[model samples]
Target: MGRMDDRSVIVTGAGRGIGRAIAERLAAEGAAVAVTDVDEDTATGTAAEIGGKAVGIHADVTDPGSVRAMVQRAREEFGRIDGLVNNAGWDKIGPFVDSDPADWDRIIRINLYGVLHTSQAVVPVMIAQGGGTVVNIASDAARVGSSGEAVYSAAKGGVISFTKTLAREVARHGINANCVCPGPTDTPLFSSLFEGNDRLRDALVKAIPFRRLARPDDLAATVAFFASPDATYLTGQTVSVSGGLSMV
Candidate 1:
């Protein structure tokens, strides 16, 4: 049997890039995934491509009401939510002194508050079902400060702390929580960060011990592992999938 046979999962921001990779990986392992994104077309397309019990749903992570409706739809479609991957996030790269307050607000809303809304929505479902797993997609910046990602790093740091606290609170219910920190992954988001700067990209690649940036699949594999039965005894942990970039 597949690792996630009969499991139902929600992967937010799953339209493309890292989120898409995670959803596709989980589906390949036999889980029915709810591929959700703010963009309905891409979300639906991804769901169609997965072509099983998967469903595409619209969810604006920054908005709790939208998140609630999305979670409700998943529960209605799948009967139960066995897993939740908080993969929705956004960032603006620049020095803190040069950053605008609006940028900070956006970063906090999508990266941090987004987790809060989704986790709060999913935990109840998991509780009623007796147990579940939460694999949060944080960033290596949170562990070791990134030069251009001050607010983003702070938001992700919050995620790590929140995951640990949530893990402690939910362990009694058999639920587990963990964080996966990806460093310089070759996703659209990564590309956007270095839009016209191939030098920056090349320098980053050379710095990684693997001599390359991480692939979305790398993070996907870690996330899947945490969601699997193999990681039943693991919780409140933070793992970095950065090709040995930051060993903290």
Candidate 2:
């Protein structure tokens, strides 16, 4: 049997990139997955690709009402809530002082507030079900402070702190909370940050210790480990899956 046989999981932004990889990995491990995205078509497409144990739900994680509905839909379709992967995030690349306030607000709403909304909506279900896991997809920028990623890093930094506090608060209830910090990765979601410029991408990749950009599967594997039984004893920590890019 697979590691997550019969388990129910929710993976946000699962229409593509790392989120899609995570959803696919969990499904391969026998989990019934609820794949969520703001774009309904891609979300459903991903669910179909993963097989019958998955369903697609369209949601805006930045909106509390939408998140509540997403959680409810997951419970209704899967019968239980075993895990939540907060992998949906947004950002704009620029110096901290150079960024517009509006950009900061937009990034924070999706990157930080979205975590809050989803976790709050799902925790009650997880608690009643006896236990659950939360894996927030943070960024290496949160740890090492990347240039041009000030707000994004700050928002993810808050998520790291939030992971620890939430873990402490819910350990008694059997819920695990943690984060995975990915380095510069090759995901469609990252397209915006690089502006579709191959030269810039090459420069970024050369800087990494691995001499290549991280793939979505790399992030997915790390997240899968966190959700697996092997990680039951682990909580409140951040695993840097950055190919030794940010070792601090």
Q: Pick the candidate with the highest lDDT.
A: 1
Candidate 1: regions farther than 4 A off: none
Off by over 4 Å in 2: none
Each model's backbone clash number: 0, 0
Candidate 1 local lDDT, 40-136, one digit each (tens): 9999999999888889999999999999999999999999999999999999889899999999999999999999999999999999999999999
Candidate number with greatest TM-score? 1
Over the full model, what C-alpha lDDT does candidate 1 score relative to the true structure?
A: 0.96
Q: Indicate the residue-level lDDT of 181 in model 1.
A: 97
Per-candidate TM equals 0.99, 0.97
Task: Score candidate 1 by TM-score against the native.
Answer: 0.99
For 42-69, candidate 2 gives per-residue lDDT tens digits of 9999999898699999989999998898
